[model samples]
Target: MFAFFTRSIAAKLLVVTGVAIGLVLFLSNLVLISQTRDRVHALTMEQADAEAKSIAREVAGDIGELASAARTMAGVIGRGHEGQSFDRQGITNILKANLEQNPFAFGSWMAEEPGAIDGRKDDVKGQADLGANDDGIFTPYWSKDRNGAIQFSTFGAKYDAEWYALAAKSGKGAITAPYLAEGTDVPTTMSSIAYPVFSGGKMIGVSGVDISLLSLSDKLKALKPFETGRVLLVAQGQQWLVAPTDELLMKPYEEAGADALKTALSSGTGNLVPNLADANGEGFDRLLFPFAVPGVNTTWAVIIDIPHAAINAPVEAQTLMMIVGGLIVLGAVMMALFLAVRSIAQRPLHGLVGDVERMTKGDYASDVSNQDRQDEIGLVAKALDGFRHKLAESNMLAAEADAQRKAAEGERRRNEEERNQSASVQQHVVTALGSGLAQLSQGNLTYRIADEFPGE
Candidate 1:
């Protein structure tokens, strides 16, 4: 069976067909899986980035409101409290009221001396004193002390932070980067708004408000639904702000990201590290996207992992089915080809061979007939039949010619014998007459010739 399979043309064709079908199915499945991974990655990243942008905008809007309030307050308290003799209690009361009204703000306060309050007040008295500076005019209040900057013993120095510097230099609102609070150790971010207080067109003080980072983290956690997979906030080449807390964020990238990140960065969206081994050494397919955050120098990437075995199951089954189907089709084709060739070519040649065999055996009586086909074999069969008929006719004519020749030979022999006999009889008759005449002349009367001789 093995030899036949190897030698048979039909069997070889089936094997080749099966292999071709399997290869086609495998490549098609690979392309499909790769494209699917890319599409899913693109959609997921787009959604995450959009959510991030929306949150950033919301934070920006909240800071905008604080800045607007500060500007309005600064316009109201024109010119540093020179000869103003204003109601300090009423002003303080208004600032407190504003702080109560705006719950988003951790604390809202105003500072004086045009540059005295550097956002670090060691004591509550110092904070209060800064609030009521005689040489400074209250503009607007916008500042928060989440880390207890006003605490007497442990108040740390807070000067020239990014937010404070921006507010003082640009005289505008700014959002600070995320950081750990001094006393609480809780991750916090601040948004500050400062408006210049002017006395006679000369700046005297500034007002600002600070917001906490707790609300932002809460919103980040809820960026996507629970079942919608993972949502990550990564700072380019740094750390992931939000990711699955259980797994080490860097580990997945170190292992799977090696190939996936390369592909994502190079190709934008496609199969990166396909068939990557997981922590347990199981292979998985990974998809990645490079998240380009606005106003940030670093690029954030998102990766998704799916098992290779799961995706390839369908492809394997499909390949098997195609191979079997191709084999069946090949079998049918070969069978038909063989039968058609035999009937058209081989069978007619076999008939001609049979005719030759019969002729060799001297059995020329058998009729050589052929089918009504116009192909080469059929034409050959027709020619053979014609030759056979001519041979039979020639044999018959030769037999007739031989019989006539023998009959003519026998007649010629008989005619020659008769002629010779007739001549002899004539010769004898003449001689007898001659002898009788001679006897009469001799006159021997005694010896008379008997009228009826005994011998006559």
Candidate 2:
């Protein structure tokens, strides 16, 4: 096969064209794949950042509701009905109505210092009804259930918890860190907004509202950006406030050791980290994006783990399409080239070979058809045919000259023989005459007289 191709012009043409096409396609494919991969990666990062910002807004909405409710309650209780007069029942009624009306918050509370408002004492701790009981401190907890039922209770006199202490210690309102909400019907993590109550230029107590993390987690889980994308929330401390798996949830952030997530959280809003591997070593591409929630003091992170396969799927498809398209074009070009070579080069060369072979056998009688073709082949054919005609005419002339020379040589040989015979005859006659003269001299007169004497 190799020898045939080297010896054949058609095959060589095809091979050269194929190689040239292959080289061009290879370089083009590399450039296309590189550009496509980079473009897709950049777009993916932008999408991750957008998603992160959107989640921040949603979480802010949840936390903002609780903070707003707490502030409203705190302002009402601090001034005692718009700073007109102290009304304990009015404050209790306002708390009850807020918990019933707001779906985001499940509870509301008002805890004041002992004897700060109505000579109430903090002695009746752990009581269910603060309005009816006699207490030195004014403490009333109002909560709504899933059935929309509102109940009155008290925040026991302990007040040692971080939520209460932080509000008492800080004169302004504050939001607590995420923690598991205790005494709830369903187990879930939650946070609270605590606003300090004040009246007459003195600190009264703290008003609080509870917000759940379950709703936020549900929203995160429901996001479907990609087939294998994962949505989870991370705190600044690297804790998993909301996660897909129960084991990972509420666990220390170090357990995941997501460097990308950590970087995004530290960089604040609009930061993105792309093409990281899963913490579990699953070999999937992950993107980490973090943003700060408005009205919240903490920077939060949202991570999206997108599969490498998903990210490269479009690139692979485009590559395959280009390869197929290149092959198709190459095939078409090669086929057209083969046909042109056969007509323009191969067939003419074959005819020239036949003409030369016939000339070698001394058969020059046939006409050279390609002589008038008006191409290189025609020139070659005309030259070869001219040489053949010249050689044939010279051979005929040489043959005729050889025949004439042989005939002349035979005639000349015959003439020479006749001359020799004539000479011999003349010599014999002369010798006879000499013998007669000798006889006469010897007195042979009688013999001459008897021979019918000369001319009698």
Candidate 3:
């Protein structure tokens, strides 16, 4: 195989073309894969961003609905308080109806200022029937039990819940951080919101509604990013309203195994952080989107965790498929090039070789083929054909020279025979002349004239 490849022009050229094509494909595919990986990564990131925004928008809308309902409750309280006194039964009926009408409203309450109800501050102070505490403040809180029955309760301490004062302080509305609502049958986590009631330019009372995080958490917990990670509902970056599990609910990011999230949390709203580790040191990216709560005049954020592996897995699979396809194309192209070289180059070269072989055996009668071709094979054939002509001409000249040498030898032999015969006759004539001279020391001329007398 090695010898064949070395000797065959078609094989050499096919190998070269195959190598060149393979190299080009390798380089191009390298670039393509790099670009494709980057593009895929960018697209996935975009998808995650869009997903987060969508979730934030939906969560914001939900909070907005609760805020709207709270506003309606506050409006009713404001209108009733404008008349000078709190109608106990009427206010109780209103709070009850608000909770009943809006299924999402977990609880509703009205907290009043001391002496603000009918000038009876000390008289009804600490009276259980009037729902007043030691400070002569009346705060009636209405809520639901596990069976969904309306329950009556009174908030005794003036500062038991901060949402009460915050609402009055803000003079608009207030929202609480995620907190565990005690004394509830279901024992769910919830947020409190309140709107201040103004009567005659003085702060008369505060009307508020409690919203449950149970359904919201359930909604968020089911939403897994990349189907591998969970979403978190974080409030003001300080509290967790919803988490992947109940154990993480209402816990601060620090205690929730996210001590590394301090920088991102302090970075405030609208910040997206990547490459952070959870409490378990698991790496992931977090997209923090602050969505406004409807009644609170504040925004809470949603965080979606994205694992790096999930993003890379699909990209790697796609890249592998692309490389496989590219290799298949390369193989096909190389095969085509091999076939073309065989047809266009190898066959002609074979004919030229046979011609050379015939010439080597001294059979120069046939002209070399492919001499008129425009390729390297043609050039080789033309040169060999020229050599053949020269050798044949040299062989013809040798034959002519051999014939002339034979003719010259024949002529020389005839001249030698004629000389020998002439020499013998002259000797014979001389001897006869000598003998005649002896006999005729007197008439030797006549003896010589008998030997050869033509000239004489």
Candidate 4:
């Protein structure tokens, strides 16, 4: 193959064309694949952002339900049942109904000021004998047990706690961060909301509700980003509300790499993190989607964790396929071109070379072939045919001149022979006459008869 390509114009042209075609194919595939990867990456990022937003909205809506329920119950207490005093039985009925109506809620309670509800303070005075706190506050707590049974207990003087104090100070309801609520069969993450009750434009007590955030974790777990990516929910204080691993649940974000979310929370918007390391020091890329619970006064975000390999898997496969397919296509095209150039050009040129060789050997009787066609081969054939004719003419003239010279030499030889014969005869006659003259004096008549020589 190398020798043939080196020797033939057709093979050389095919090689050149093949190289040009290969270059074009390589460049085009490179550009197309690069653009495809970029578009795919952009599309995945965009869809990831939108998906995170949707999950954020769902969680926010769920938290809002808990806050609204707490505020509604507090409003009822402050109004006091159509301007009647809200006694202990009234509080019991309200708390039970609140728990029954809001199945998402884990518990509901009212924390009253000392002597605040029905002026009851001494009702808990004897409670110090028990393990419960003895602060004289009539705090009625209604909660569901593991079997969903409604149970009652007193909250004691937890009125000064942050949840209660924030409500009492701000005169509004707000949701707390998630915590693991123990001592239940339905143990899961729980949060609370506290709302202040006001009667006659004066502060009275605080009513609150607790909602389990297990549903949020369940929703996040069910949600798959990019088919194989993970999802998590991080609260405002860098707390992990939802995590892929249960060990990360209700823990601070530092466990999941401080470098991961560096300024994302401060930015308070959606962003991306590259090569984030977890507590195990395993790395992943994450999309941070910011959200919030209503009236929570803190930003929360849905984090979509995608593996580095996951993001590049599709493009890498495509690149491999394109490289293989491009090589195959280039080979096929080059083979076709090789066949075409050999047929259209090399074969005819081979015949012309033969004609030229035959002409060199003085074989001009046979006509040169391919002179009528219109191409380089035809042009060469025409020139070869013309040379054959000119060569034939020169040979013919040479042959005629040689024949004429031979004829002239033959005629001259015949004339010279005739002249020599006559001269010899004349000399002999003269010698005979001299001899006869001498012999006539002796025997002239016998000599003349003997010497009678030739007939012309």
Candidate 5:
């Protein structure tokens, strides 16, 4: 079946057309898919930005509330000084209640003379105790930084300590930055609000609240619709603050981050990057878009990947349909051509047949005026007419020759009858003369006197 189809000209033409159309459609579909991917990425990034802004606004409000509570607590602690012991139980209870109310907060606490202690020494002591010791404790939190980096107040498993020193030196109220829990494998960003508790017009201690990066991750994860599609929280050229999972998104900017910021800053639009291989060496098409998060100098980007094979199904089907249609048209044309040639060849033959039939019936005596036409059939008819004329002339000549032969035979018989009659009369006369001469000699000379004699 395949061989037959391949051999026919119409089939071959259809195959060629099918291939050409398929290629054209394939390229068109690729362009369309890429464009669609870009549009989707742009829309997704816009939504991501709006989502991040909403969350950031909510976090900001929470920080403000925490700061207010910390200020009230610091005032209470300061006023209770000088012969009055601090209400440590009350302060701890308040911090625990606030932390429980906001699940996003990892921990919160107040510290006096934070810079006086060494963070490394505290971290080593905490690890040595295996979390059994609770004295000399410090609350861990992040300081606000546009450059996304892991930062916190403590070096223990519960909090990062890099942000603590910066916050302490800056003497700023609150700090926000990306971080990872010491013991746990999860990476996050925290927003911390710190207030100093004063004693006699001098700074005594700082109180603050901490929010986990998991909150941002949860919000971004909820925005994604596809299993393969992901929303990445990338800070310009630094790192991915929020990503899908450790295997898919947890990495430095040069490692696994979607380079959307570079593309957007350079081109002012989304860019597409195809993955040549996954963990299993599978290839996939991907799209990226960079978006500027509101109220933040740093930018964020989103990436999406799709299978090329799935996107090309419609074009293949359309190509097949076109090929089928072309083949049908070609078949129709060939059939028409065959019929036309047969009709043209048979029309003249019909006229020639009619002329031959007429000639067969001895009808050539009639004038063949129509035979003078200037076509092959007409030429045949004219030749037949000439042959018929010659035959008729030969027949007339043969009839005349036969009539002359019959007339000559009749004349010869008449002459032979006259000669026979004359011969009989002469014989009778000789016999009578002989008898008369003999009578004369015997004195009987009167033989001539008898006119009615049998001898005459």
Candidate 6:
């Protein structure tokens, strides 16, 4: 193929045309694909931002209910419904109603400081004495069973649980960072919102609700913006809570590199991360959309990672279309070039060949019509025409010389015949004279002189 392309003019021309067309197509496709990819990335980022915000709002609404419910119940305890002491039965009803109202709240508790509700020590009923190491704080916990039944439990005042201690000291409602809560049928992750109870300027204990995070994990798993895209909840310090699966839970999110996640968390906006690699050494260029869940103290962010291939599919399709169109145009140009070269170059050369053949046969009268065309073929025709004229002139001079020689030969022959006749006449006259002389000598000269004369 290389040799044929090197040797043949049409092949060379076609190759050149193809190469030019390919270069043009390549550049055009690059520009088009680049523009298309930009547009897609922008649009996808917008959509992802919207989705992240929507999910953020849902999470806020779900977990925010804990704080709201805890504060509402604490206000109830502070302002007694009966205008007397705090109603234990009423508080229990409120906790049951809160658990039933919000599906995300798995448990509710009201833990009081020692002697805050009743100063008498023995007034407390159903209290299980742990040991002499107790801190004397009383906590009443109400939780719903998996089958929707309300169950009661108690915690010691000196339990020293972080959520209770923080809420008790802060004297206000506060949400805890997500943590795995024990004592469930199945171990589950949860967060609690604790609101300190106060009655008449006196500090009481804390009232709060536990919001289960299992649903958040389920929501994250169900989310799929693209075929390979996923949503992850990155808590403070890059801890993964609600990721794709349980194995990914509580793992460090920075294994995929922390720069993009840090940017998203700090900026609280959508960002496009270039060529991010995963833990297993598989790299995927992704986009990050991070939004903070409202009403939470933890610096948590929701992030969405979209694969770059999802954004480039349309650009690739458009580039393929450009290549196909370029190929069609190249084919058309090649056909036109081949036809033009054949007509302008090959046909005239074939006519010159015919002229040479005729000249070889000694026939030079025919004129070459293309001699005045002003191209290389015309130059050849003109030179052939000059050779034909020269040959014709030489033939004409040869014919004239032959005619002159024949004429000279005929004149010489005529002169020679005349001389011969004259000689014959002279000979006859001499013979007559001789005969006359002989007759005279013999006495008979008058007989031949009168009848035979030289002029006759």
TM-score of each: 0.44, 0.78, 0.80, 0.79, 0.44, 0.72
Candidate with the greatest lDDT versus the true structure: 3
- Those runs of model 6 whose alpha carbons end farther than 4 Å from true positions after fitting are 1-8, 120-138, 144-150, 156-160, 251-256, 259-273, 279-281, 285-290, 336-456
| Candidate 5, lDDT over the whole model | 0.52
Error of 5 at 106 (Å): 4.3
Give lDDT tens digits, candidate 5, residues 133-199: 2334443333322343333333332223433443444554544445554432243454444555556
> Model 3: per-residue lDDT, tens digit, 9-74?
777887888788888888987888788778876876788778878998888776777777788877
Give the TM-score (vs. native) of candidate 2: 0.78
Candidate 2 per-residue lDDT over residues 1-456, each given as its tens digit: 999899998899889988998899889888988998889877766776677667667776766776777787788778783375756777777777778767777677777666666654555444445552344466676765556567666545447775677778867676666777554454567666788888877887777887666766777888876667778787766778787686767676663346656766777633444445666655555555666644435677776666676658878998899889988988898889899889988898888889778878877788665887888888988988898898788878988999999999999999999889778777766667777788889999654422222231
lDDT by residue (tens digit), candidate 4, 1-456 = 889878989878877888898899889988988987887778778878888888888777877777777778888888884287766678767877988898778888877766766665655553522212356666667778777788766655555666678788887776667776644456778767888888778777788888766766776788777766788888777778886688878788864445546467667767787776665665567898777678656678888987655657878888889888988988898888878877877778888888889888888898888888898878888888888999999989989999999999999999999999899999988787788788777865565536886665
Runs in model 3 with CA error above 4 Å?
A: 1-5, 84-86, 118-137, 147-150, 158-160, 255-269, 277-283, 402-456
Model 1: how large is the Cα RMSD against the reference? 11.7
Candidate 1 ranges with C-alpha deviation above 4 Å: 1-13, 76-86, 114-166, 174-191, 225-456
Clashing pairs in 2: 120-135, 120-136, 121-135, 121-136, 121-137, 122-136, 122-137, 238-253
The models' CA-based lDDT, in order, is 0.52, 0.71, 0.77, 0.76, 0.52, 0.71
Residue 5 displacement (Å), model 1: 3.5
Q: Runs in model 5 with CA error above 4 Å?
A: 1-94, 101-112, 115-160, 166-178, 183-227, 235-237, 242-250, 255-277, 290-298, 306-456
Q: What does each candidate score in C-alpha RMSD?
A: 11.7, 5.8, 5.3, 5.0, 12.3, 7.0
Native RMSD of candidate 2 (Å):
5.8
Superposition error at 19 for model 4 (Å): 2.2
Better of 3 and 4 by TM-score: 3
lDDT of 1 by residue, 228-284 (tens): 333343323434434445244322335445655655545545334556675567665
